[model samples]
Target: MGAKAYFAVAAAAISLSIVAATPAIAAPRAAENYVAMGDSYDSGVGTRTYDSSSGDCRRSPVAYAPLWAKANSPASFTFIACSGARTPDVQKQADQLTSSVSLISLSVGGNDVGFASVLTSCQLGSDQSCFDKVAEAVNQARTTLPAKLDATYSKIKSKAPSAKVVVFNYPRLFDLGTCGLGGLSKAKRERLNQAADTLSGIISGRVSAAGFRFADLRDRFNGHGICSSAEWLNGLSWPINESYHPNTNGHSQGYLAAFKAAIG
Candidate 1:
């Protein structure tokens, strides 16, 4: 072949090789039929942006579930989670699920063990009272919470058998650092964090046993707990209902990031 022809052939071959080396872009996936269910955490109580139509359910646009839906533009999004929801209440919420639900995210069991009450006691009562309250809550988490969670998970599975269920557990409320006066002491904070760990462990076990995905938030929220320099959780806010829950940043950065990772 002539030198020019030979050069042209080599260039063509190189072009072909480059094309072969490049990966094909995957087609975008179909929109999901998502259902958000559980308790205040799932409903975005701490964000303080609620849908009045939801009434006491307190579903918030800033919560992780809605945030995901808003960003992804899922085929359909249903928000049924309510404030103060226990495991049984979550089970009831699952009743709204159908076979069409392609995705589900849940955060529960905190209320089942009376965590709010425990936190209140820790805040308002004596040191011993705080210890006692945490211990009692931990006991319930280990003993009673497992079965209840199992039941709720089973119900979710039964309702939306094809859905990809992701169970999100709570974050450690405190960073075990010294805040000013009227703050929980390091000892009390340690016990509370331990209780959170116990609860996360129990929920993880149950989620695994039920063949669902478990999205642990403890690591994600590690440096952003209440006492941290950058806090993602509320600390005894004006509306007491917002206390001890993830703030807007927590929902967007912590919980939403974990949910996306879990689904991906």
Candidate 2:
């Protein structure tokens, strides 16, 4: 073979080897027809900024879902989650789903187990009352919530069978640490956190059974509960409805972070 031809062949082989050794850049996540559904946590209840058109639902622009939509610029984005929404309300929200939807994010079941009421009772009533309320909520979470969650998930699947649904569980509200005056007693806080754990387990289990991704926020929001030095959750804020929900920081740092991890 000619020296010039041999040199050209060697250079081609070297170029091929370099190409093979270089890592491929990961493609960006595909845009989708994305829908956000569920309750107050998903609706941005504690964020204060809300869309007037959402009315009593109080959907906030800064909530995790909208933040995700704003960042990703999905093919389509719909936010229908409402404050005070229970599992049945979620079933209705499923009506917004369609076969073309490619992504969904949901945070539900807290209201199904009357978490808001439990929090109110714990804060305003006696310690025993708090324990009693926590127990009741736990019982409901264990017994009836599974079926409600399963049915709601099924409805969403039926509506948008091709969508990738991600179910986000609630963070533990209390840090169980010292907080100056007017907070629940340590015993009450422990009970409430335990109840939250039970609920998280149930939701995670049901989400897995339904073949969907479960994003557990408890760990993500660790050291950021109501009593923490850098708290992400609210503690008895005004406009009482915002009392236990995630603040703007929580939605951006906690919920949005978890959702991105789950979807990725």
Candidate 3:
């Protein structure tokens, strides 16, 4: 071949050699299988946007679980969490978890301890009544709630043995020092805050024992409780039942970040 032809052939051979040496770019990894199991907070009760197909569960598309799922694009996403779900309800949700599940996230024990009722009673009733309610809730949180949480956690582990479970704690609904907006008295708010702390401590400890990651939201919502200037939790709503649950902003800014960190 002539000089120019030989040069062209050599250049083509060099290009092919370089291409062979260069590693091919990898395709994005497939999303993990995620199942969300818990109560109203996990179900997104306070948010206006909801999955009506879920019926009474009120699983909202804007909920932290779905928000995480959407952002991460999980291969599979099952939102089995329900409103008013106690530990028993969580156990039932565990039935949906299978071996293929790779990720799990939830917030439980709130309803198990009658958190809503305590808040409502504290708001509408007298100080003594509020104190009594707080005492009862604290008792349940200490006594029955732990066992219930453990049982639920065990069931979860059994269902998805290899899954990375991320358990989220409920945020305190009161700013204590500032929480007098509704009928809840300052003293009652302080007691309720204590109740929340008691419940969260138990749940967080149990989460560790269960070999699951615990996402703490107590401090995350410090200045964003029901009493804050910019409350993340809804105080008293017209529907009434949705009171004190995290609002949409709470789910996005507060719970979503905690979940992503735990899962990652």
Candidate 4:
């Protein structure tokens, strides 16, 4: 899909999409005062993807970054999140961060397109071949994600070193117990999580390698994967139409985990 409107939730996965709304008021995010940065996941993409106006940023309450901030005691915060943002968008859009800030988090890397492409490619492949191909894609993310994270985190640090930086990782598609789509084998989902795991490892490792604290949310969300009864993520209907994006629940889980890690 083309770049979505600033405040609009374009066609995305139902499980993962949060429609855009008017730019909501920036709520308090930390005790020591902090700021938030990232893509639609941070902006609550899946919780609800509707616009307060025709052209406002979707500010769903279920979005993880805002929820995480509100969960803690009130502190000053600045938000620079828009849907469909990738690495370059961040470098250009979110540069005014302050040095004395207390915390920061970035939930990204799903837009690299390899995962979706793999999903599509493996849909018609034999079971063994599907598994093998998915494995390869995840492996690629393992190697490439850290460097991208490193550059972004360093830029964030240059603007806000004192802030506690946490790289939020992606969740598994479906529960380990469940895999296979109506048109595809569930084994691919396992491969999807394996990739997510690899990316998570890269993110956590790179963050720690740079002397920053890393919060690994992968294991913490074991059974709550995409197709779980309580479904925390939405692989097919994410971004409401795009599929594979996190939903409101996904953002909530991320926010809860990130906040608890930052303070508790």
Candidate 5:
């Protein structure tokens, strides 16, 4: 071929190479910006894949927020929920929220009226002391917890005005009988279960009043509590703090199902 013809061919090849090398611009995502906020139940405290990189938050990738985001492919997911968070702690988590956020899933209030302390006292103390501690917690749940929940929920709404907030409650811990694995006596279990019911009722009432969806897991965990043959919640662990939290099955089956349904 002549020099001029060869040069023209080279130019054409170069143009084709350039075109092939250029990357295609991806289509924008049509998913919401989802933020998960609240306490240990929302943070996956007892899950195997706990992310220490998130510090004391103990955020597991298997946690419902991350699981839901993975399944649905949200535009973005921010998990600000921490372990041992009370209603006040949730206020800090809500700081991560913005007007652009489209979905919020959280589980708070378990720590607000000292639910853990009550459980600990009941699990370790004498029957009389256990009942007394529970009574105190019940009283606080009736009187103090409502105002705290209202303030936190209101703040969350204000921060993420357009977001659909779904607040999840803790599961009932017992089946009214001892499985003989944990230390909780039958009578103690009844009192603790009543406390759980009280807490759930308080949260449900406030969540409904705030126009937020309440994801009730009590019924779902009926046959899967700590005393069940197939337990979904951890019994007394050596660390003690890890006990009473949801196990892997609880997150995958209990919380995930309720969460997906609530969001839908």
Candidate 6:
């Protein structure tokens, strides 16, 4: 073939190949299929430390979901986490899934029996049965949460059959350090985390049985828990008007790790 003709043909072929690799019309639609749901922490309450934004909900833009979704670029997100969301409440609030969705993230079980009040026990210098209280709470949630999650997953799969479900295990509240006004004992705080771990262990099975991904942040946030030097999780006396929630960096740190580790 003539030199000019050969060069022209090679350029055309290269252009065609690039177009094929790029897919001119039907890309994967990475921006859709992401939904974030849950309670006050999910709503990003304390990240801003009392930012006047997000209206009454105080949803921080730097919250976990947003940060995670941003990290997993090209992936769009639908955040529905509020200040007060129980498992049943989220079941009601989560949007109807459409055709396109890659992931759905949610955290719940705080408002079911008034989580703040329950946590208050730990905060109130009531270390006598803190572990026992945590155990009981986990047991109760174990009995009930599976049912709700099963229902929620059923509805989710019905619409976005291929979508991956990710359930976040709430991280540790207090490291072995003083907390609340009473100054919690390290042993008591450790017991609390252990209880949380127990709760996570039970829920992890349920999450897996339901074909979802369970992100375990307990180990990651071990030393940096509520009373840790870094203080990933908050205590009652946080700088933010919001109480006992992860800080901005904390959310991003934990959420991003969970997102990276989670495959559902």
TM-score of each: 0.90, 0.92, 0.87, 0.73, 0.86, 0.77
What are the per-residue Cα lDDT tens digits for candidate 6 across 81-174? 7777776777665555666777777777656635466576766646776656666676676677667667766666676777777888778777
Model 5 lDDT, full chain set:
0.87
Q: How close is candidate 4 to the true structure, as a TM-score?
A: 0.73
For every candidate structure, what is the RMSD over all alpha carbons to the true structure, in angstroms?
3.3, 2.2, 5.7, 18.1, 10.4, 5.1
Report every candidate's CA lDDT. 0.91, 0.91, 0.86, 0.64, 0.87, 0.71
Better of 4 and 6 by TM-score: 6
Which ten contiguous residues of candidate 1 have the minimum total lDDT?
25-34
Error of 2 at 41 (Å): 0.2
What residue runs in model 2 are displaced by over 4 Å at the alpha carbon?
1-30
Tens-digit lDDT track for model 5 on 203-253?
Answer: 999999999999999989998987788988888885766788888899999
Question: Model 1 off-target regions past 4 Å?
Answer: 1-30
Of 2 and 5, the candidate ranking higher by lDDT? 2
The alpha-carbon lDDT assigned to residue 156 of candidate 3 equals 95
Tens-digit per-residue lDDT, 46-156, candidate 1:
998999999998999999998988888888988899999998888888889999989999999999899999999999888899999999999999899999998999999
Off by over 4 Å in 6: 1-32, 49-56, 71-75, 129-132, 177-182, 238-241
Task: Tell me how candidate 4 scores on lDDT.
Answer: 0.64
**Cα shift from native, residue 202, model 3 (Å):** 0.5
Best by TM-score: 2
Where is model 5 more than 4 Å wrong at Cα?
1-30
